[model samples]
Target: MEYILGAVGLLLGAVIMYFVGAGQRKKILEGQSQQDQSYKLEAEKVVSDAKLNAEKIIAEAKLTAEKTFSEFKDKQEEFKQEKIRESREKFQRFKDEFKQEKEDELVELKAKREALKEEQAAMKEERASFKADRDEILKLQEAVKIQEQQLEQRNKKLTEEIERARQKQEELEHQHERFTSELEKIASLSQEEARVRLMEDVRGKTENEAMALKREILEAAKEDAAKDARKVVINTIQRMCSEMTIENTVSVFPLDNDNVKGQIIGREGRNIRAIEAATGAELVVDDTPETIVISSFDPIRREIARLSLKRLVTDGRIHPARVEEVVAKTKKELTQQIMEIGKKTVVELDIHNLPSDLVRYVGRMRFRSSYGQNLLKHSIETAHLCATMAAEMGMNKNQIKLAKRAGLLHDIGKVAEEDSELSHALYGMALCEKLGENPIVVNAVGAHHDEIEMNNLISCIVQACDAISGARPGARREILDGYINRIKELEEIAKKNQGVSSAFAMQAGRELRVIVEADKVSDQHADELSFKISQEIQETMQYPGQIKVMVIRETRAVAYAR
Candidate 1:
């Protein structure tokens, strides 16, 4: 029984140990299973996340493709719109060009049609004129035939009248011879001697009467002609003497400061000497208060010097080299100024198509002055006067232009000393001739000063223009002393004349009035005294305009007041 109990305890111990060990193994197995489950769950979770990520990536690719397709479509639409706009713009440009071309074509066609119409109209007028001429010739022929018939009838009547006159004359001669023979027998003296004395006495009386009638007719005609001539002269003078003022050439330049005068006369006078040499001018630095005079015989040189000096003073740079440079520049400027003045003159005068050289010559006259009169101004005035007279005379406009041009150029030789070898008139003529001026102009220029004989109307006009310019009142002046001496000489000449009680010189010495005793001078003697005074005045005086000599004959009978 003890052995059996021990065996049972051992068996129980082995069983308890086995069960505890098994339980421990089971817990370990369970932990292993839980770990495997957790790993499986984690593996499943990773596969699910991978599937989700792949789906997301595919979805994102699809969306990207759709977006790309949409963008491409938009791009295509935009490109199409741009192409359409380009086409429209191109179409508009083409349409405008076409419209303009059509308009131009239409205008050309219209002009051509108008020209054709004008041609047709001119042709019709010409045809009508030819027809009129034919009709006029026929009318003239008919009139001529009628005139011829009338002339034949008149000639027949003249022959019949002449025959009758011849028959009557023959009968008269026979009767006269018979009467003469009867008278001779009755008379105491011979017929031939009696007739001679009677004829001689009648001839002497008739001759005296005829001589008186001849003298009276001649005197009346002379008086009428003299009166008409005087009227014409007065009328011409009055018409030509318009108000004219002579213009002088005087240029003035202003200075900046007095100190500039020293700079102008630079270190040791080098600047002034250079300027003088370059411009050929005399610089007069006087006490005129900020002014200097540039004096030169050549007006152009003086103008250049004046301008150069002004520029130097203003720039405040004075040296020999600078002076030379400024002078050259001033010369160029003056040349341009001269040319501009010339061009302006031509334009003002309405003179076109002048030769280039001729225009230059005309400009040179700006620097020339004659007796205080600006040459250019005088030329312009002469041109205007000539043109006015020509218009009044109804002359050809081109001919008038030639005359005016010749008048303006009459003193052109004075501008060029080298060309002044000939007289002014001759040189002017040669210049015109070289320039191929109108023959009338060439001839007029040569003959203006009577260097050549006056051969054309233009020449006479030039001479008249010169006289008008020089002889008008205030047009010219002589020295005051010279004028006084001339007046004194005239007074002395008149005082020396005999039978003159008082003598008065008037009309600027153009007329002399002599008062003589009435008892000493008869009507015939007065005429003789006037003639003598006129002859003496002509021989002694050298003056323009004709001098009039009047011998006054006055016989006053005074009554005494009681």
Candidate 2:
């Protein structure tokens, strides 16, 4: 019975196990079936999506094709239009070429017709010329026949004249032989000796007559040449108007106030000392109101000092350093100013082609003086005088220009910076030669002072003009100090004589008057004194004109009634 119950329980347990397994398997199968259905549904959806995508792709391809076709049509139309335009252009060019060819043919035909007409006219002229030439030939043949007849007549006349001339020549020879023998016997000499004596007499007479004629001619020429020379000089002087003033070494610097003098002097005169050392000039502050005198032998120095002082006074900065700076700057400016003055002078004088260095020297002449005359003014006057004289002497334009140029540059050496031992004339000549001046101009510059021999007419003109300019009245003046000293010396010279009691200088030192004591000097002695005094004046002193020495010795009975 336990076994039966155990078996039943096992079967029940087994049945229950089997049922549970079946249920699990049934659930798995259902789950598998659901997955299969889901897969099928997903597949169907994929296929539908693919069809839709295919339709969309077809639609896009159609659109692309239609667009391509439309573009092809557009391109085709453009190509056709281009081809048509090209064909039309070709046709027009062909028509134009044909027309041009026709026009050229017509022009050629017209030219041919004109040429034919000209040829016909030339042919007619040639026919007329041939006829005229034939007539001329006939006339020439007739003239040749007439000439042949005249030549035959001349030949006959010439034969008869030859016979007569031969007989005459024979007779003349016989006569000459007889005359020679008779001349020898009458003169008691050989034929050759007699001929020589006659020749000598004729030669002596001719020589004497020629010398007298030559002397007369020379005398006449001297008178005429003197008259012409005076006329030329007088004309040149009349044409010129020049300044008459003395150029002094001292330049007056005008100031706005007297107070500016103190500033220029500076503290302890350091400013002035600096100015002097820098410019090589002296600043003289004297009692003269509103004027400072800048004194220097070099006008350039005085000008620099003046300008430097002007700048210092204007800027109100007066010190040693500032003074030097201003003076240096002023010197540069003055140098540049000198160059400008030179250029202006050359331009105004119409002088050309001068070197820059030489031009600078010309400007320096403005600050130079010769015998109390401004060198530049003197040069200008001399230039004008030279030009005028050259013109008067019948010189051409080129020679006149040369004369003027030479005159202007004649005194260039006086302003030279070098301290040369040579005279200004020679130095000027060397400078001109060094600078490539014309030979004539160089000679004129050297010979103006008569230091060198003149080589040409222009050189003589320059010298003459220079003298005329300098020797003109009121053209130059003696310095006041010099004049006073000269006057005192003139009086002293007369007083130093033994017979003279008192002496006086008269006529601007042109004459000297000596009064002698009557008791000490007789009339004869007075005459001797005068001669001795005149000799002494001539020997000891250099003067412009003759100085008249008059010695007075008169007896005076003088009683003063009081």
Top of the candidates by lDDT: 2
Give per-residue lDDT, candidate 1, residue 445: 75
Evaluated at residue 25, the lDDT of candidate 1 is 56
Cα lDDT, all candidates: 0.71, 0.78
Q: How far is candidate 2 from the true structure (C-alpha RMSD, Å)?
A: 34.0
- Global Cα lDDT for candidate 2: 0.78
Compared with the true structure, what per-residue lDDT tens digits does model 2 show for residues 445-561? 999888989989999999988888776655667555665676788788888878689998876666788999998876656766786788677778777758888887888897988
What TM-score would you give candidate 1 relative to the actual structure? 0.44
**Candidate 2 minimal-lDDT segment of 10 residues:** 238-247
> With candidate 1 superimposed using the best TM-score fit, by how many Å does residue 556's alpha carbon deviate from the native?
23
lDDT, candidate 1, 399-503, per-residue tens: 788778877777777786463468878887888889888888888878878889877787788777866665444444555566566667766676676777887
Residue 317's lDDT in candidate 1: 86
- The runs of at least 3 residues in candidate 2 whose Cα sits more than 4 Å from the true structure, single-residue gaps closed, are 1-247, 254-258, 286-291, 478-562
Q: What is the C-alpha RMSD of each candidate to the true structure, in Å?
A: 27.1, 34.0
